[model samples]
Target: MIRALALTLTLAPAGMAGAFELGFPVDCTLGETCFIQNYFDHDTGPGMQDFTCGPLTYDGHDGTDIRLPTTAWMEAGVAIHPVAPGRVKGLRDGMPDIAKDDPAAPALNGRDCGNGVVIDHGGGWETQYCHMKFGTVTVKAGDQVGRKTVLGKIGLSGNTVFPHLHLAVRKNGVEVDPFTPDAPTTCSAAPDPTTDLWEDPIPYDSFGFLDAGITDAAPDYAAVKAGLPPRLEFAPDTPALVIWAFFFGAKAGDVLTLRLKGPEETVVDQAVTIDRTQAQAMQFTGRKLRGSWPLGDYVGTLILTRDGVALEQRTLSATVK
Candidate 1:
């Protein structure tokens, strides 16, 4: 059986007005085709083999890829501005462009997420803008930026088949469907531009007024608990056993330590650094084990800490045959 555990942590006030907003990185022009690609959409079709459309892998495609055609012959170096005010968390430059056929390359010079910037919008939310032109990153990691601030210029770099920006939002370190559709899925050959389009910046509507009213609400513990789907149910008649555990609500800079204990507290002491400023959801599965120990109680604990302060912790128990 597989279960989902989510723990949310908010580092801002209970309610801060307009803490975060979504805006188009570039002005919508005739040739500029800006659309949001659903995480699921990226999974189906010919997009499967391309890892850029899949879930975040060890290779570092951390956020969703926002594709837009270039309106003009954009210079190799241009400036990308911040859609909203936030602190710059990560930046990389001096890389080269990636080949059109290879999606695995880094963002710069055959790299993925080429010369990019990640901005922390506070309140456990973050946004990543990838595929900037090389040497255009004007801000360094950890710099504070305001709305409309130029961070870099658009470019054809990284795992990009064309000139486009990959943008994504993470809440409490977990990526959600920012482009939630108002209607159900309609199977078709051509991509539906209406429902398929990325939702306009949540911060400003067409009129430039705050839409969602930037919020710094405390961690929604209840929502986090409710968001997690029920654990996978298993039967004793099952032939082979395979179990997975998915966890959400971890932020970058947090130290994640996992321990599996059966009779006593035996620690595995695996340490991982959450580099993505956005919330992260990870699934850990137990590979096939030929033999099974005596059916008993087992405990799995996930501890998250940052700067010596314990942020979140979760424990789960299971019985084996």
Candidate 2:
């Protein structure tokens, strides 16, 4: 279960003097090619909370983390763009895109922001883009840039275990949540976006599918995170057929349904109610072969429901050859 904050609070004073609007910072399509992995931590004390008063953030986390579903996506390149026009104040490059936990990773030594760039948007406002890939920084320290400028590609660098762009917005020198620039003093309700800094409102998203696939047996979690290509076909004599899903933002009591069907018969159908809140989760269902699977196409579907509302569904296909 998610740990809840105990203190009661109220909204902070409205508005920042001369605050400006910002645009989406990535080149990929939202929800399809990239997802918001974390948001600015709004909790003033020890516990963490996002602008929506959710557990999508870590304690003292001061940025919104935009992530790709796989390292392969990162390797293929996902461009990082500025959220607004600004003058490049400073930049870093040439940091290899390696997970911090990898045996070959370099020491952090305070370079946790990894290969990053900082831009000054005037009026004491600035933005920082972090965890960028090596040799991808395109602008010099003093370049004037527009929102369309490609600063770099997101990467698994710095203090990060995954590939993402940790974007931090600031004013003067203090960190600010672009989603709630007014600095609401309470987590009582979702912030009113009328006062937010986004030129277009970015919806507050908490849950969805990250990856799904089919295989002949149980899949490894590490391999899923590494974005291994899924097995598209199985042999007739394979031991079992497995359907698995990788997702994020699971809440207690949420229901997950996994169903598999062959051209001639339904193989496995199961629904599971989650018992605890999880930032990320995985589930699978499979059945051992009864001699051999019928030679045909197979489809696997995953559905996530919260409060009886079907929130997401995804499907993968395979064939017996």
Candidate 3:
């Protein structure tokens, strides 16, 4: 479902130089408000690898995916900007923002990019911004624009199940990885940034937490994907106490530990090992209330570890009233 639109675009030329310094395409800060959900696939065969030789991408992925934490953030609005100055080449708008799997979703019919914008940077260089919100496109075809121009807002249009900007770059009409113009023929050394496109360095993260919270019951995966509402106070008669986390860049064998500490004592301490790699994942652990939870505060901690070393830890607190 991803990048199916990009694969159909006609190529420019093969050997043109892709020398250009690009800026961050999304408005939010990386690793905090937004994250790189996918990178350009580097492997040539029927396999997948990112610039870092990591599993952050899928086979045939042609762009870097910058994703907001949830649909709620999409509703609040997050803008998408061009990486460089150019004339708006072409654009499409008015696509409904619906999940790919939703029963009412429209047929792709090569409209997979869904309400996106294309900018011509000259010299056979151009960029595409896809999956943008309906009615938020501020620029029109043939309009002059720059990095500061707000093209549109991130959305769940096209073949996406989540809100994100699927950004693809081309030189001479041929797809190229902005992080590294030439995809690695072999996954070996780390990516060399000197020849990359970004004006400032975007750190390569292997894994991190997207969101975490304390809830009164086991989290609903679909609701979590939509975005969990913040709640810090719970009734004493709550059915259970749960701590849940949403994360990305997971690898097989990674160990996740979820611990909940009540006012006077430690309540639940649980560890789970990931058996498969996932682009985004959710996990949770908690205890059901017997009569009523102790009237005090509870802290839930989530620690994700790899190779026996802790990689990231997030804590959420809740109070019983």
Q: Pick the candidate with the highest lDDT.
A: 3
- Model 2 error, position 84 (Å): 1.1
Model 3: residues with Cα > 4 Å off, grouped in runs: 1-18
Ranking by lDDT: 3, 2, 1
In candidate 2 the C-alpha lDDT for residue 55 amounts to: 80
Estimate, for each residue in 271-312, the C-alpha lDDT of model 3 and write its tens digit. Answer: 999999999999998888887788898888999999999988
The residue ranges of model 1 lying beyond 4 angstroms of the native Cα positions read 1-19, 28-64, 68-72, 76-78, 100-111, 181-321
How accurate locally is residue 282 in candidate 3, as Cα lDDT from 0 to 100?
97
Candidate order by decreasing TM-score: 3, 2, 1
lDDT of 3 at 159: 81
Where model 2 places Cα greater than 4 Å from the true spot, the runs are: 1-14
For residues 1-321, could you state the per-residue lDDT of candidate 2 as single tens digits?
Answer: 111332222222346723688889988877878889888777778878788888888877878898888788888999998989989999988778888888999987778899999999998889999999888889999999999899999988898877899998877766777777776334536577787788886877678788889887888888888786978989999999989998877889999999999999998999999999887778998999998899999999999999999988998899998
RMSD after Cα superposition, model 1? 21.1
What TM-score would every model get versus the actual structure?
Answer: 0.42, 0.90, 0.93
Q: Give the TM-score of candidate 1.
A: 0.42
* TM-score, model 3 to reference: 0.93
